[model samples]
Target chain A: MESIQNLLIGFNDIFSVYNMIIIFLGSMFGTIVGALPGLGPSAGIALLIPLTFGMPVGSALSLLVGAYMGTMYGGRITAILINTPGDAPAIMTAQDGYPLMLQGKGGLALGISAFSSFIGGIFGLIVLVFGAPIVSKVAINFGPPEYFMLMVLGLSTITLLAGKSMSKAVMMALVGFALGMVGSDYVSGFVRFDFTPELIEGVDFVAIIIGLYGISEVFLNIENLVHLKMGKPSFKVKEFIPSISDIKKITMPTLRGSLIGTLIGILPGAGGTIATFLSYATEKKIAKNPEKFGNGAIEGLAAPEAANNASVPGALIPLITLGIPGSGGTAIMLGALIMYGLRPGPLLMVESGRLVWLMIAGLIIANVFLLFSNILLIPVFINIIRMIQKYLSPIVTVLCILGAYSLNYGMFNIWIVLIFGVLGYFMKKFDYPSGPLILSVVLAPLTENYFRQSIMLSRGSFSIFLTRPVSLGIILLLITIFAFSFIKKGRNSKNQDYSEE
Target chain B: MKLMERIFIIGMMIFSGLVIYEGIKLPIKSEYTIGPGFLPIVIGIGIFISSISCIVQSVYKYKKLDTDTKFISKEGATRLGIFIAVLTGALLLNEIFGLLISMVVFMIVILRYVEKYSWFVSIRVAIISNIIFYLIFEIWLRVPLPGINL
Candidate 1:
């Protein structure tokens, strides 16, 4: 009942003329930006953070939230119409989506994705409204010990085996963690291993993220540059509705995807990639018709698309309550909040209850906007992509560089953008996920600072983690996940041998 | 990738050792006592452990795999090194030439030379981007542009 009242206030606050206009503008702007290749919510919110500086905290957050949700949803349009994915999460969509477009089901795929995204987004927000206050209260009890343990759990969860082995992922995570520790010591104010003054301020989060995910992807793309030329794929859709069978096939996958995305989103540092991957893998393992998975299946398209958008709201849960960003997009959202003079954390909900509720309401409104805009603009989006590659390619490149540069007022960041663009290219060529590395880099400071503080508080006693029930539970959960993974791997290896035989 | 990983691990270990050595200069009476060196030592130990683990894993993988297996191809590795070099160059130039001039030059040089954009295309992009930055930061946001000439 209390939650219901809070939600009613949220709706009132969000539906105001000023807030609605901001949401619309933000959604439109986000769609355009996300339609461009390589720019995701990170770039969108970062580019617009300055614009929110003078606005009231709720209004400012409402605008940014609108943009964030809009971009994730909008990225799908370009991904489906063109063979190229608009962002990393959209990559999976392109796999089955492009094939569908080639076969002339592009409009239907876009319609399904857009509708599913709305459902997923709404489901995530419902969870947010009902569960947020309780979650925030629980999060408030987290001291450094609990925070550190939780980070360790998050890191370990992401470190589970890739295709070949867990060791590789662990290795990559350790490298990222080490790189994260390069700058200032939060406790003693002593700089360790910072050779230059620039580094003393530490490696900028924006630069490293852009470097690993953005720049690395560019480099990876360059390898295929000679072979690849972009002209929009042509597809015409007479109907946009999913048939009864198609709806039945996709419904369970979408729900499962939403659940996966929402759960992962709540866990700090776990982002859409993990949620989407887990959802896809889970669907594959359970599907009655599993053979269609990598071969233009609608379920494949729906699950990941639903999961990706769902994760946005999921990611917001941690950011609002715990002041922890679950993903890159959320991190950028946090930066926007700080720019608006609203620090996100425990006190935020109680201190500015109406504002928090209003933001949640704004997210719901944005989802509605996303659904209407995506469906109405599908044909236009596909038609516009018909422009020749020579023009579209340069425009996208410019946008990517522009979006990267706009994050901080530094021109050096542009260089970081290009550098990481190339690095991203190479990482993609290899099987290593730029996602985990980028995620690790993003979460490193939080993990390290908390771990350091906890140790200091305990005076070097490892028993503090055990003494705290929440921390103890988290640590136990971490062990259980690893243990489960090990058992599953053994079973998988047996199945692998059987398949081979 | 193996070479790079090994180099990174070794370098980190050496760096960690140096940090620990410096921390030795800070007086500490008890192991449990919080001192300036305590956090540094914890970090140093973590690095050492990870570095050793990385080396062991690299060796373990080497033994497990056939000689034909390639962890990271040479071309990919070289491109990665070049990328890092460009980033380092950008940071250095930012400090040396300040923000605006360095940025314009950085944009032109990298887009044109490294990325192989035509001079005309590069110049157009560089100029337009520079002006946009000027408007957004200096004009709209009121963030003072750093003196570029100095």
Candidate 2:
């Protein structure tokens, strides 16, 4: 009864004119930003954070959250229309979305993707609304040891993702840890890496975020300038809505993707990129004819796109519960919350249940609008893709710069964005996963500070990490993952040697 | 790539060694007491181990590969270097000119030069972006933007 009443209240809050406008504007801007390759939710929200400072916290969060989810949906447009993925998560979408376009089913593909996104988003929203309180309560039992173990478990995901080169991922994680050290010590007030006073506040989250996502992507776009060509396809108005057949094909994949994405979202540090990729791979593996997956399969196009949208709300779970951002985008959201003077963790739910409920409620409303907008806007969005990529690329590059600068009202951050832009390009070139580095950067300070604090409190006794049952469980889980990965790597190498022989 | 790997590893070793040295200088309360330096020292050691592993892996991989390619294709390396240089340039300019001027100038220059947009387009973008920025950031949020005192 209370849940229903809360939902009703949430609807009332969302129906207000100002809140509706915020959601619309956020979705519109987010879609445009996400449709452009390279600028994902992290950069978009970071860039927009400073701009949303004066508004009521709920309104500001509505705008940003709408944008975040909008980008998740928006990336599919470019992925389907062009072979270019708008962001990393969309890479999986491009695998089949581009193929669908080739088959001249771009409109149908877009339709199914939009519907799948709606379904998946609703699923994630329900999870957020119903599951957030329980998760927050569970987090209340977490001490420093639990946090330390959680970080270790999160770090282990790098090994899971590193494929054959787990060592490089570990190395990158260490580099990220070092980068996290650039600011002052939380305990003794000693500055570690502040060679200049500019770094005394430590590496600005927005700066590093822009550097990685915005600048690196700009360089890549510029490098790929010659390959900037568009393919043409006429959309059928009737096919803008998915057929029953299309829905049947997408249902299983979308369900599977949403479940995986939601789970990944709840876990700290694994963002949409991993969730989407994992979902796509899982769908392909489970499909009867795997060869059809990258060749315009409806399931292929729907799975990752749905998962990506699902993961946005999923990631918010930990952010709201433990005050730990599960991914870089969530980290930006966390930073925004802090900037707005709102503490976002277990206490946030306890002290400000209304705002939490309102935000979750706004997401459901936004998802409905997103579905409605995506269905109607397919043809219009496709028309924009017909514009010259050369011109669009320059505009995107400009947007990246402005976006980076908008954070912190400083150009220094813009520079950081540029640096990370270049570094990201090289990291890509070197086959190093940028996701681990990002997760490390987001979690490193918290992990280090908590670890140090716990150790200091325990008088340097390391046993506290083992003595706490929750922390011990997480640590054991990390060890199990490491052992499993080690065995897997050994088997893979053996297979490689056998192939050579 | 091998040469780049070597340089990176050597740089890491030097950087981590310096950190470890600095970390050791912080005052310790007791043998059991975790000082301000403990975490840094641990981090330094972790860096050293990771760098060593990276160097080893690079060497092993280098031996297995055909050494035909120049250490990272020149075009790729140059593009990456230029990207880094531009970013570093932006940061330096921010310190000198303040945030807004440096950012607007950086965006305009990057769009015009590297991206090769026309001067008219670049300047127009700069002006329009600056105005929107002023409205959103200065007027709405009340954030104090750097490099725009005048």
Candidate 3:
């Protein structure tokens, strides 16, 4: 089959000794970074991107994908050992994982989650392998009008889900649009916001990314530097391998969570956080003893952990097939794809099919590698976390500064990082979701070009969007979402009024 | 918190105005198609309208805003302020002392003074981290990392 052939092509690319080593090392390093309290997949990739500047595209992508997968796997450590979740998706893990730790099943909890994470990852990968190609095939036929509508739907969905205040989300997105306007316009060849010579090239969203996710996180972490109260460190190999009964318990929940994660991940903006929450809720509702849900329940722990890892691959589907990122982490990966000089879209497979396949091959290898590495290296990871607790903020700050400076071998991006670091801190403190803003910046140029081209094709008629069947369908979906949100808002306000009375 | 919120809103409004002013100077249309200005102008107006709506929402939301809600404790805020200040100072130092030296100094200052790590521990971490950075970025990556300028 073509799928097997494509995978073979990928394995051929990944088999080189140098490429294999990079994935192995990147995966281990990513786990350490992700296990740190504040760093996530985005920060792990952004800070390490400078190292890949001179490598071959295949190797570079392999390393990045390895790190991305490692972060997903590593998120469980802090959740199980300490009550602190490494990132948002791991929040549900802590609800039961830490409780299980209290009940002296910490080693078993880690083991169960690791196996479940691997299964979830493999399930998502299967879907990605078959799903992306099929989606790409259908997307290849889409015209500019449909592309424009798809982009609007993507941005609108992210904005709506970004924060509690829809208005603030829109404001942030508009700010992103403004930022995206900085460089030369491709269609008209006019520069709108060319205040600086650097602005002539446009705001480097990557620099903004490093600033937002990397440096801003350091700032926040330093504010409340709580030393993690680690549990017992020693775990024998037997303690890590789940028993048959344990496997039987987690099998159905992990599968159900994987299914929910993949489906939600395919929908833009509905990333791992939502998937994990939904999975945890579903498990609780269907549990034989709901009273046991959060008090050391292995099903409660396994489901969200599976969902968390599954959503990583699920988020990649849109990025690979449609050039639309499904989440904040994938948004950065989209930027990386562009940085590698490969265009992402329906034609991505057609043009750079070999490279795409190689990345996929690398992801499969990374997923497997992380499972064993995470289990064996558990003690080492905990020790490292405890050792570096004091000097973490300073070390991370240095890495962030060095990373920004290395972007173009200049000080300009360092300044951008600093300024945006401040702004990003404020945005976080104010509860304004940065996801919509970042997505807006990444998609702005694409959205603008598609809209302009669609208008030109239809002789300046706005009705072109509605005339196309696919575009009309997207429009209807958007309308339904808008109506639903409004009704939900009304009901929420009424409920609040009743509570007050 | 209220003061910071007010400043951000006014700043955003001003930024929106500047965007609109610059956008209108560019041609809004090409040959039967939208031009560069089309998107910018639309975005500027969107930001402006969204800012107004945000103002209205904040007025209602902040009315009963928990006055006692501490955004950050005094100690936490002070530490954050010092962190940013030191980080800014280090970037300036990079122009003079080079990346490695400046960052090492930054590390020392934060560890010894801010977090109160002893001199022995502070210098050990600073030197070790800088060496690793130098080996990776300078030697392996061939990044042309700035050396000691002074």
Candidate 4:
């Protein structure tokens, strides 16, 4: 009953004219942005965050959350039309979606994808709404030790899943942690590595994000410019809805994908791309006609699309409940939440129930808007792809500069962006994953504060971490994960050697 | 790529050593708990160990495999250099010439030279983008871009 009342209040809060307009605009903008190749949801959100700086927290979150959800659905349009996925998760969609397009069922493919995405999104939201509060209820009793262990688990998971080479990912994460430590200590007020006055407050999160995701992405895309032929999309209003038999076929796959996506989404560092791939593979394995899986099968398009969209809400569960981001997109959102002076964690629901509920409510609303907007604006979005393709690099470069500079109105921030831009480019060039680096940067300070506080509580006794059951459990989990990764890596390398001969 | 990986591992080891050296100069322990240097020292050590392991792995892989990949081409290297130069030039010029002027010049150069667009198309894109940015950042968001004093 209380949950219903809270949701009602949340709806009331988001129904305001200003908030509604922002949500609509954010959804439209996200769809268009997501349709562009190389600028995925993370980059889209980072680049657009500056625009929301002036709005109220509820309004700002509504806009950003709407965009985040919108991008999940929007990415499929380009996959179906151009054979080039707008984002990483959409790569699977392109495999079957493009084949469907060649068979002159592009409109139907897009319609099914949109519908599956909506189902997945709503499924994920339901899980988030129910699961987050429960998690927070348990997490509320956690102390510094538990928090520290949780962060360690989070960092380890990201490192293990981020790249092929565990050592490189670990190295990148350590670099990020060190970079994050280069500011005045919060408790002691001792400046650790203040090379400049700007370093006193710490490197601006927005500047680094813009540099790493935005500017570096621009550098890469410009270097490998592939001219995609933007063909006209074939669509009839009558053909938009799937047939009854087709719906029946996809219903089971959509449910399975949504479930799989939500579960994977809850895991730290395993994001939408992994969920989509897993879902696609699972659907193929279960299908009676496995050979037809990637050959324009409706099940192929439905499963991954559903999985990717569902993973969006799945990723948010940890962020809102435990103050830990499960994926890169949620990490950026966590950064935005911090910028708004709201600390996300178990207490987030207690202190700002309205904001939390409203964000949840806004995502549901956004998914509904996404379903309609994607279908209604498919023609417009296709046209936008052509227009954006030519000027994508230059436009992104300007946006990156503007986004970085607007943080504090200082040149120093821009310089930070440039330096990290170069660093990020090289990291990408060498196949080093940047996700772990960004995650470490965001989580390092939290982890350090918790560690120090735990020691203080225990009077410099490191055993405090092991004394707590929750903390001990988390540490054990981290060790298990690390051991598993090491063993798996060894087996894979041995297999590689055998194959090489 | 293999050689670059080896160089990166070596560079990381040296960087971690420097961090440890600097960290040792700070207060490692406080009366109640760990000091600020604690994390840096821990992270530095972690990096040093990870980098060493990376070097070992690289050497093992190198010994097992024949080098068959070309890391870069002349054209790619030149393109990257030009991109870096343009980015640096924009950053340096943003303070002196103002953001709009520098950005306009940067966009024009990238669009015309790097992207190989015609002069007319390049200037049109530059002018239009500048206007859009000026309107959005300066007027709407109320963020003051660096501007030349009249």
Deviation of model 4 at A221, angstroms: 2.0
Ten residues in sequence with the least summed lDDT for candidate 4 chain A: A225-234
User: On residues A324-378, what C-alpha lDDT tens digit does candidate 4 reach at each position?
Assistant: 7877788889888988888888889888889999999999898998888777777
**Candidate 1 structure quality by residue, lDDT tens digits, A44-63:** 66555555644677777888
Candidate 4: Cα lDDT at B79: 68
lDDT score of residue A284 within candidate 3 = 98
- What is residue A93's positional error in candidate 4, in angstroms? 1.1
Q: Where's the lowest-lDDT run of ten residues in candidate 3 chain A?
A: A223-232
For all the candidates, what are their Cα RMSDs to the real structure? 5.3, 3.8, 1.7, 1.8
Interface RMSD of 4: 1.4
Note the residue pairs that clash in candidate 3: none
Considering only chain B, what TM-score does candidate 1 achieve?
0.74
The DockQ assigned to candidate 4 is 0.70
List interface RMSDs for the candidates, in order.
5.6, 3.7, 1.6, 1.4
lDDT of 3 at A20: 86
Q: For candidate 3, lDDT tens digit of each residue in A188-258?
A: 77888888888888888888988888788877877886556765587876787889999999999999999
Clashes of each: 16, 10, 0, 0
The model with the greater TM-score, 2 or 4, is: 4
The DockQ figures for the candidates are 0.21, 0.42, 0.74, 0.70
What lDDT tens digits, residue by residue, belong to model 2 across residues A1-501?
Answer: 555667677677667899998898788677767777767787677656645656888898889888888888888888888787877788998898888878878888788888888888988887887788777888776777787766666566677556457767876777677777677776777777667777888777666766676656666665655433555546766776887877888898999989988988887656788888899999989889999988988898788888888888898887887676656677678767766667666678777777777788778877888888888876665555455344444444445565555665555566566667666766765666666676677677777767776786688799888888888887787788779778988898999999999
lDDT tens digits, residue span B20-81, model 2: 87678765444444666766687788878887887888888889998635545466456545
